[model samples]
Target: MPRIKTILMAGTALASVLVLTPSPAAAQSTTKPKAEEQQEAETSTAKADRETLLDTITISATMINEAVFDSLSATSYVGDKDLERIQANTPADIFKTTPGVGASMNGDDPATAINIRGLQQYGRVVVTLDGARQDYWRVGHGSGSFYIEPDLLKAVTVIRGPVSNAYGSGGIGGLVAFETKDAGDFLNADEQYAISEKIAYESNGEGFTTSTTAAIRPHQAFDIIGNVNWRDRDAYEDGHGDEVRWTGEEVTSGYGKATFRPAQGHEIKLGAIIQRYEDYVTGSSGSTSATLSRYDADTINNTYTAKYTYFDPDDRLLDYAFTAYHNKTKAEQTQVWPTSSIGNFRYYDVRTTGISGHNSSRFDWMGLAHTLTYGGDYYYLEGESSASHFGQGEAQAYGGFLQWMGHYSSWLELIAAIRYDGYHLDGETKGTTTTPPEDESLDGDQVSPRFTVGVTPFTGFQLFGGYSEGYRAPGLQDVFRGSGAHDTADGYIPNFGLKPEVAKSWEGGVNLKYDGILTESDILRGKFTGFYTKVYDYIETDFTITPRMTDNIGTARLQGVEAELIYDLGWGFINLTGALIDAELIDTDNPKYKGQPLENAPLDKFSATVGFRAFEDQLIFGGQYLAVGEVKRTQRSSGTNPGQVDGPAQYSDAFELVNLFANWIVSENLKIDLAVENLFDVAYTDPQSAWSYTSDVEQGKGRTFKIGVTTRFGG
Candidate 1:
């Protein structure tokens, strides 16, 4: 493709950035430079200082401690301040400002599913919490969803393309990693123990939240931290002043961690987390018409992990890490049907266990610097359903990879990596009508590869590109679960011969930084990316024959452009972000669906924010504007055999929103935050929502007021 050739040429001219320390001689020479040369010299000096600050912030998603601009991938980072500024209680709120990313809320459940570049569901976009994969899902009329509490998160990292094959399998859509706070994040250098308390309230939902955290360093080599949160809320009113039933919920969460250093170069950590949610939902379809049956649901998620690390800068081969973890999630629903004898029942359950380890070595050969990383991982999963009888299956998968990074010169860097994966499944249903499992087996394996090249032509600019491949094995549900119960595709059966999904992707991007561009303290950073991905053997529901099932769609393509900018104007900062995505079913077995736009693919999105600080940087204020273009979709058929619907009449309307927030540090130990969402009370429906197809669509939250207070006891 012409795009690929252009990116290759750019890569050959630019190189990767590895933040380096400023030279003492260069710093001293800045004072002696002439007036005409002084500005350029000072700019160079400031660039080094700013780059050092960025490098200190490590990104856990990539497993490398390099600056964000140094990689040949599209990435973004959100810190604690950003989270608080948005008053984000949901994943949609947290990612509202991010480009090329979309989130869908599962009705009144408060759980969320992620979409990246029009690909999602069935683990396509890998999500992790504290290095442990979150892989629980259920087939429903709405989008498949996952769970995670935001109150415990300290930071979030998002990689928006298949350029991250070395991270894991089935991440063709992208990766989202959440990191929890440690004692070090709360305590000052001289403080050994600390306690923080927080309380918050929101008017629209009549929601109240309380949180407490304690950190203690009992000894020089040992440290521990614990956190607990409780929240209660009532149903919230939408923009039309009508209460959205089943929106009320009660939640409780707990987290604990302990770290110990046994030697000068060895460290170990043990961690555990638990979350419980109690709510009453009026319907199973998550639709306004589902009030015929009410359900009282209890959801629980638990995880535990142990990790060890060893590092010695003097030894080239000693940087290593090992981890073992277990996670379980269960959702039980008690239904109150008008005529049912058994009023209570269990809904769904899933459990997972895994172990992984990796090591890296750095050395110099000839004139090039090389770093080699290799690791292996294995996981076992079991899923069960009580009342619905969706499926009962046991599955496992294992994989390993070897990656090498070489710095050939100051202007060129290269990366090559490959991974091998194998998976096996057992248990299957008897017939299309029956949901009972019978003995059945399936197995498959594949190898995926990645190659990347980065070029840096100057101190503040980088151009990079990469080509990578990704693979996704069919999940147990795709092969073992009988779909007869669903109304969409009647008499749906299971297909044991289903093939694995694969993707070939290409990406090219440029990052520019200018420190002291106009003034000594001014800084500007911008990044732009162009990406294209072609997925083969794409999975979709089939309705061709009597026994409807899942089969491979020939091919689908997704291409997009994303841009982000941040400018520091000495007194405040301005940020701008935008994305344009186009998705199409290029080649399918059914010619009628060819050239159709993929579901949930929004055409254009844009966001802008302006923020400033006052009172010696203790007080901050910000405002944001977000706009989204119309989404093209296939409408549901009115008949029992609703084969396929596509055209211009199936488009959803576009919408825009405005929000404002403020943060004030009253004192060294106390702070307050306030935010107003949907300031104009505009009625809008997210394109990804299940109810967006109807004229009487469910509206989003109206003008809402939120306030929070935090107090520190000791540090």
Candidate 2:
């Protein structure tokens, strides 16, 4: 066990060092201010040009949004135009085409899990929606993001490694934030009252996908947006297209948003969201049409938010953002119990309300550019779970964060961030608190810090190094899961006391850009980057094989690497990306199978994609390929994984697949698109539970297709 754990830690450390290094230009941007610092951006923000691989995107790689790149250890951006090109139904779809990115089903569920640096799902990677921290812990999906309609999004930025201080905790890998539509540039001029709408429908036969969005910005001060979605799929098939018999899901959602800027340097936004998912599940082996799955759950997520922002006097570099919101998540799940007569059930109702405020100030100190950001947040969540026993859990978390950025010219930059968070949980089980010896109240606090330096010597060339620490507070289930839910352990049980897990990671990488690099005639633009991260308290869970009780087996170590590359030649574009992760339990201090791969961590995974566009951008085409490495599972005292760890460790052998898609212009007012997933159908099982031994996971959708169209009236 010790040896295996050591390898996991060592592998991760090495990966962190091997990720692409930073460049000279990035270093300068961090430490110094340029002469034309507040100059109008001429880097191409044209809406009619249709942004492609050749365009450069400016991001808040540091505390303040800037035009500089290569100032951070790992980060990637997807623009509005790019989102349209993908014709995606969900946010997860975009990850599929991004380099060094991975997206898979959490199970046979609608909540598709996303991974970066091989660490994701749960709250490992912080996800912010329009700057609001969205915790994935409300149960279903169990990640940082919920089901947000894709069309309403304007951009998605991924800080692929632990290099920022924008989170309170659980940013072990990095962070991904989704920014909804904001039309500052789109409606900046009086004559710019034009509308861009999209309506798309897609179906691979595995199910049907459809969505429509309406956005209007009659003036720069206000933008109104709304979206709707519907999906349905019958039982899916295997790689051979033969019906797998009994796997299906149905979902529908609607949303609305409004942004208002009544005065200069100030803005306010409000939004409403609602979604419900229903599953008509049929078990794997076709047992009684619906009795097979140990997990048959239906969930709903409803949210509302109001936000305000203040820009500096010049709106040139300084900004402050504040937001407050409320969200509710509820679910009911059926568990197949041991006794035929006794049916087991699990239900949870969770409500969360919180407020967050961030203030960032940017200025030029002497010849150097300086930006400082600080913020704090508070959230109270009330939840209840029921089974053989019902338990109510209330947890409140509060924290503050700070970040400082120093630029030494456009070639070098530095940043430091720190955050402290405290959590308290007070609650009791339904019947006898004394039976489980309920302590009644638990309190803990964690501190996380990050440091990064970036250097950029030339345009599009960057090098960066970063150090960061992250942690996750124990969830209600981790410390309170009962015996009836257990399958492989000694009758299910729960531990009232559990500690938070932590990780300290460091990464150094280089970023390269190719635009007008090879020849003046070349229109291709490309970027390549690599990174690594290491965690100390890589949290893990244990279950008894016979009784099915969950246990926290202390802490472990985890490490992984990530890489992405893309190229565009006007005529076509190509992208390649991959991830490698290694994890194991350390100091198990137990005799039950000492050395084994940590549950749910795949040793290696990667993907490849290519896209083409016809003359005048009237036609578009693309395809994708993916790979999932084999995994090793440990024997179980207990686990939700139906297959014992010893069994094949369920080698979800790596497989290859292809996807094809296209878009055609119908007229000035309308357009059409066609997308096919799994063009060359490949049989593959994606890992789901953190406890699953065999990884008898969700199967990839076989041959799905979608057709969609959009039309618009005068703005």
Winner by TM-score = 1
TM-scores across all candidates?
0.90, 0.81
Best prediction by lDDT: 1
- Clash count per candidate: 4, 78
Write model 1 residue lDDT over 1-715, tens digit each, in one string: 2332343233323222212333233455444448757865665665565445443365532355565656668887777777879877777788876778887664467567788888877767887777777777765545345677888888888888766655666777888887788777777767889898999999988989998999998776888989999989888777787776677899999899888999888999899989898986444434544334566878888988889999888989868888888888888878765355248665778788888788989999988999998898888888888634355688888888888889977788888888898888887655534555467888888898888888988777788888888887777777766654334544566678989888899999988666655555566676789999998988776644445666786687999888777766545877777787888788786876688777666436777788987875688898988777777676523336546444334766677789999999999789999999989887777777654343343457778999999998775
What lDDT does each candidate get? 0.74, 0.59
In lDDT terms, how accurate is model 1?
A: 0.74
* Local distance difference test, candidate 2: 0.59
Cα lDDT of model 2 by residue, 1-715, tens digit: 2333343344344334323333233344443355444221222222114233334454453445542234465666777766766766556678764544555443245554556655665466666666655554433222223555565577888776555445445566567777766545344344334454554444443455566656677667878777677777666665666564335667787677888999887889998777777753222322332334445668787778899988856764557777888877776777643346235666767677888778877788778887888888888877676644333577787888888888887788888888887888776532345554444667789878878888887766577777777766665555554534334434445555667667677677766554432322223223334444445444444542334444555445555555655545455666656556666565665545345666445436556667887755688788776655655555543335643544434454455567777777867667787777777767665553232222233355566667777664444
Q: What is the lDDT of residue 627 in candidate 1?
A: 75
Where does candidate 2 have its weakest 10-residue lDDT segment?
39-48
